[model samples]
Target: MTNEPTIRSIIEQELERRGYSLSSFASRSGINRGTLSAILNGNPPKPIAIRQLDLMTEALEQPEGHFYPLYVNECVDSDQPNRRRVKAFLLRCAEVGQTECIQEVLDRIVENLSYIPMIFEIGEELYEKGLREESRLFYNVVIESEKYQHSERLAISHYRLFRLSLGDDAEANLIAATRFELYLYRLPEDYQLDGLLHLANAYLTLQKWVQTEIYSDELRNLAKMVYKNYERAYLQGKAFQFRAERNLVVYYGQGYVLKGIALQFQRRYEEIPEYIAGYADLSWFVGLNESGKEEVEKFKLFAKLNTYNLKVLLGDQSIIPEYIESVKKHPPEILPSLRVIVEASNIHNFFIDDILEQFNIDTGLYDRADNYYRLEVSKDRYLRLFYHLSVYYLRKKEFEEGISKILITLKIAISLKNYNYFMKLIPLFERYRSFATEGQLKEYETLLEGVIKDA
Candidate 1:
């Protein structure tokens, strides 16, 4: 199980066991010697075509399809149309982590390339199941397959792959962004607009401020193009799936939010409040009260909460009490995943006398921490929430809790490889060093030592 043999490895082993030199075997099997050599010796061994494999089977006096069963144990016969069954089988193989088998099976089915859509569908399912690495393989297969080079599926695959890499790998994000831009020219304006938004978002994450601004402007211009088309359609008394005016509002508002988010990362707190208000107004108009047209209430609430958090970070504590009351009044309106962030903001600023309510929020956050890892776009806020939790515990004179929270904060910061943030927390830990018990302090020191060793 630790090192299951690949098809090529097994073939090589079988050839050596039979005392046939590779050249002799290639001549006997009627495969070109160079192609056979490449198949056997390539860095990632190339897959054998079915006809070639069958010829090798005959030459080796092996049962027909012998090599295939050894490699793709659970793979079905290569039928082009049983896409649903193939999708299920591939997902089953992926679930067991049989990457080699999956690749081999896919190669065997390449002659029936109509199954590519099913493969992409399976990839989407795998992504939803949290199998990112496995899902990425499926997407890569579609990208590499020659038949799909000019296909519209290429755009869809590139976009999904980009989403998978966003916030997790900057280099991968850039590569995906490039593919999206390259493939998007063949697509419609809607797709181009979405592609621009993705590029802008990625550049924002990379702190490429000039590039981000450029893409943001492009997105705004594309929205105008789409709006003009919508107007023409409206003159003919036609309807679009999405309202053009609503889309216009969203695009302009998103431009503000995107710039605000980039500014937040740059620590330009002064410029954010206006953008936040604009985004909030548009979000409410299009999201909640727009004739029940859009389901964007969560976005609206997040924008509202973000404005409040920014105010706290900017030393506007006078609003903290009102903010806390509003959040409590509409608890259901807040996204469950963001409840912890909102409460953490309150804990960071306002002094809460209701210990039970605070405990409930903390426990709720603990139960939902898994969601935090999946929220890569909100990583900065996630890190800040933990930092504030640490400070909250310290302020409350809860030494064990404070130390534990700070340690978790450091671990997350380090995992992100944000060394600047990691370095910043070192001094904060030292600032609260006196609050910890001697034993706790020793544990903290040991943890920091490991960070140095591992880093």
Candidate 2:
């Protein structure tokens, strides 16, 4: 009958085979002779640390992580798992790229279900240490095993997953954002401010106007409530634990800015100014720390820019000159600003040849759209900009220019798998089909064929 191998048995046999004395092996393993003796000979056996086990494994001349499988016996097959030893071993397993061992230990740890909190705590520590992939394992364990539907730990795990999962694909990010939005309110007060702001912006980037409105309102109300409490705390010489990464006013102001933007997108023009008014005069807002004051100033500038853009959207062409000048002053605002101007020009049937020409150099740099803002958000804006430019040119009977821009838009939309834009522009291309040049017409056919195949 074969006896199952354990760490102690394996180490003892390895020592015997190597003809090493206990003191010599202790020196080789960098462990003290007394501790090594007690570990090998104590009646119940002294607990071994992950670091010590690694040292012993090296002394045994086995591979790194050679002792992990055997150590799981030490971690769990004993009377009960010692929290510190299990936690340290799990963390070490993550650090050393022993995913299989991590899986083994986690599988055993979760059997009792009480290890979820420790798992989440380790996930947070790993995340903070920049071991994101390692952190995801524990975070996912917490998410799946946490029994309470509304536990703060579950909410935070969801939040961290959402954050870690975000990347260049907006459609993929939309899925992550949707999953996270359900837990927005369950976060701590400080985290709620951040969560709501991010959720609102995520929906805004994806052009989900209704979700944008929902979370922006939540952020606005929450920011205002917290602002009041913060002021009262300061006045009464009490302390408040509420904190967010940004100066509080930035969240407060973005809540209003994003709310107005969502309204503007839905043609809820009359409603926008009311929300815009919410942030326009934040100079009177209570908190005026240096950073807070700077954010409020940015809000005031946005107030002017959005107010001007709003007038143009309402077909009040008189605001064009002042609005164009305002946008020119803010260099980074040029791309999105031009998108609005092009849409308004199409809507109001007004001219913007000089305005477009003025910013032609800036618009040509759409490949670096992420330089101005977050990558996905900036790319989405540029996508819309091209679509608007195409429509504006077509509606104005600038057929050649229109076809060129429309084809460009189609290329971008298809590469992005933006079926909504592809469908919209195909109809416009059909409407203007008679006017296309031979080359433009051929490219259009190829693009259409590609789309049909993709569909």
Best by lDDT: 2
lDDT of 1 by residue, 44-115 (tens): 655555567668878989875466555463235346435554565577667767677678777877656676
lDDT, residue 332, candidate 2: 67
Clashing pairs in 1: none
Error of 1 at 62 (Å): 26
In angstroms, how far off is 145's CA in candidate 2?
1.4
Residue by residue across 223-294, what tens digits does model 2's lDDT show? Answer: 989889988987898977865768888888899999999988899898888888888878876647898887
Q: Considering only N, C-alpha and C atoms within 3 Å, which residue pairs clash in candidate 2?
A: none
C-alpha-based local distance difference test score of model 2: 0.84
Candidate 2 TM-score, C-alpha based: 0.79
Residue 279, model 1: lDDT of 54
lDDT of 2 at 276: 82
After superposition, the stretches of candidate 1 with alpha carbons farther than 4 Å from their true spots are 1-101, 109-135, 147-152, 166-188, 192-221, 239-253, 265-270, 281-315, 330-361, 364-374, 377-379, 389-404, 415-417, 430-436, 449-455
Using TM-score, give the best candidate's number. Answer: 2
| Candidate 1: 10-residue stretch with minimal lDDT | 284-293
